[model samples]
Target: MRCQNLVCGLVLLLALGTSTVVQATKPEDTAATRAQGQVLFERTCLFCHGATGQGDGPAGWFLGRYASPRPRNFTAGSFKFRSTPSGDLPTDQDLFRTITKGIPGYMPSFASLSEAARWQIVAYVKSFYPGFRTETPVPLPLVGAPTPQLAESLDRGRALYTSFECHTCHGTEGRGDGPVTQAGELKDASGLQIQAADLTRPSSFKNGASLPDLVRTLLTGLDGTPMPSYAARLSDRETDAWDLAQYLRALSAESVP
Candidate 1:
């Protein structure tokens, strides 16, 4: 039992995406692991992902409309929470992280599960998409360090907000009440009416609200939503996402307290 516990812990450390060290071997998709994963998926994930991972569980029926987040269809392979580029299959780590963190206001964190069990869930989710087996996913480079929350940085962020016409969707004040929302022109991938997130409350951010999270979300965009990846425009502008993250932080403070 002592040795078995240590082996589990070691496997967890090697597979954790947050570790600075490169990941070692992942939990192999052996019959034993696959069996555990399936049981966990049915117990924890079947309400949304269904028996076969089609995002059409019994509970998935109600989440299909305006401003309502729907379950993801795993078989389609069009993941939005990936660290990899748009259209790319998310890495095993990406899926692992999402299962660990969960989406705010939509999916509750599954941190209650042991790390090994979480990895099992990730493996189960990956089983729905064949692309996970064939493609190697690579995350983008972290842009410069979190931009200093200084006046100059905020100012740069403010300027970009306008020049880039972010105001068109985010509004002059970073509220979700922008022209598009007013006109009801914004829709998600499923054609559900959608509103841009109110930047004033970072806690409500779907992807995450940390400075790095903001930067990554800005760079990657939420694939199924109207939010777009600004990676091309911000290319080589090392400070862009950083500064922008600071600006978003300032907006969040407005509603936080």
Candidate 2:
């Protein structure tokens, strides 16, 4: 009985030691991960993002000529969807979300991919820009819920729409046919012509159509685009950004069939 007990103890110790080793070698942003990501990218993303991530793949060219928005150039380091502050590098999770959800009309959702594989791709994509190595992502502050007084909130939101001069780009009726858009004056950092979102079409929102998503856009703005961050511009007492978001939501609601 004593000899049998000793063997059991030895087996338990060996099992625990193996578990520790497995935990220690868990996958991270290592060379192996990047290489696996590269392979995945070549298989899935190279058609649109390209071998160099310049958004200049053959399919990209085909799409650019016919598509309104082109594929993103990772080399530019200008991501549109993010939880981070405007002009800041997005967190790993942000990239993961973009990969999972994708842009509405332009990018296809890769949610089918394993989460680990998606993260690996994110690591590889970040490799395109050296800034990712040195910069830490700064998350934007959380937005508060709309004021309890619904009508009063909408009223304030309407006033904020005018005060913020949103009509200059989104049009007075939220049709996206504002003078700037009419003149084709809006250009992204890449000098590519871009259009203001039609506020009436909530379904077309690239980031998302949720209230929180709208508020986040108002706070963080779309980097490399004309949208400017309101986080710094709005005063602590001013709930103007939230009001604006509310107003936008109302416009979208009106357009619903």
Candidate 3:
């Protein structure tokens, strides 16, 4: 009986020792992963996105004012071109797309980075936002040209609108009754409530309505509100902007006639 008890005690001690080793190894592995991500981000993206993803990087200011949108403030966690709804966190793949394709105003394509490096960067970036988890995969429009004709643009644009979760804050029908709408309480970095523009009435436009003007809004994003620039956010070329413009036009048209 004594010998049997001794063998069991040795087995328990071995199990405990193995568990301690595994727990010790995990944190080291995590640190190594983060370090790899830091190296890649510093070497490639820090030029435009800033050393800490502040959107005020060196090239960030030099990009000059244009009709296009700009990079996002990752610290704020407001992504302009995500498939997820506004105010929601973006998926890992969403970050990957923005990183790989590059936004028009702030970032350019990073065709040089390997797929593995891109994934690492995605992991590193997400660390900045607390409680951020990968969002569900949101699909894009299925049956339309990247740049649809004026006639089909609204139909396709609706898909883009839905795919991008514009309805989350903009309302399903663009009425500003979206899930995030809280009775004129959508504020900016400031404590002001961010107002969602009513698309049905052109007269209600605090901003004007020209293709260039709208495209610029999409690119540069309106300051002092939840509207961040989508220039680097969306994947479609000018086509994404073009199709969306058409959709907004159609919405405005409905309000008038």
How well is each residue in 145-200 modelled by candidate 1, as lDDT tens digits?
55568999999999888888888888888888889878989987878777788887
Candidate 2 lDDT over 76-152, as tens digits, reads 88888887888888878678777877787778888888878888898898888889999999877543444433787
Model 3 alpha-carbon drift over 4 Å, by segment: 1-29, 64-70, 133-257
TM-score of each: 0.86, 0.83, 0.45
Residue 191 deviation, candidate 2, in Å?
1.8
Report the Cα lDDT for residue 27, model 3.
23
**Winner by lDDT:** 1
| lDDT per model vs. reference | 0.77, 0.75, 0.58
Models ranked on TM-score: 1, 2, 3
Over the full model, what C-alpha lDDT does candidate 1 score relative to the true structure? Answer: 0.77
Reference-based lDDT, residue 101, model 3: 56
Q: Candidate 3's residue-wise lDDT over 133-224, tens digit each?
A: 54444523211122434667677777777877777777877777787874655765535355476666644543335443344356556554
**Top-scoring candidate (TM-score):** 1
Model 3's TM-score against the true structure: 0.45
Span of 10 residues, lowest total lDDT, candidate 2? 17-26
Error at 126, model 2, angstroms: 0.8
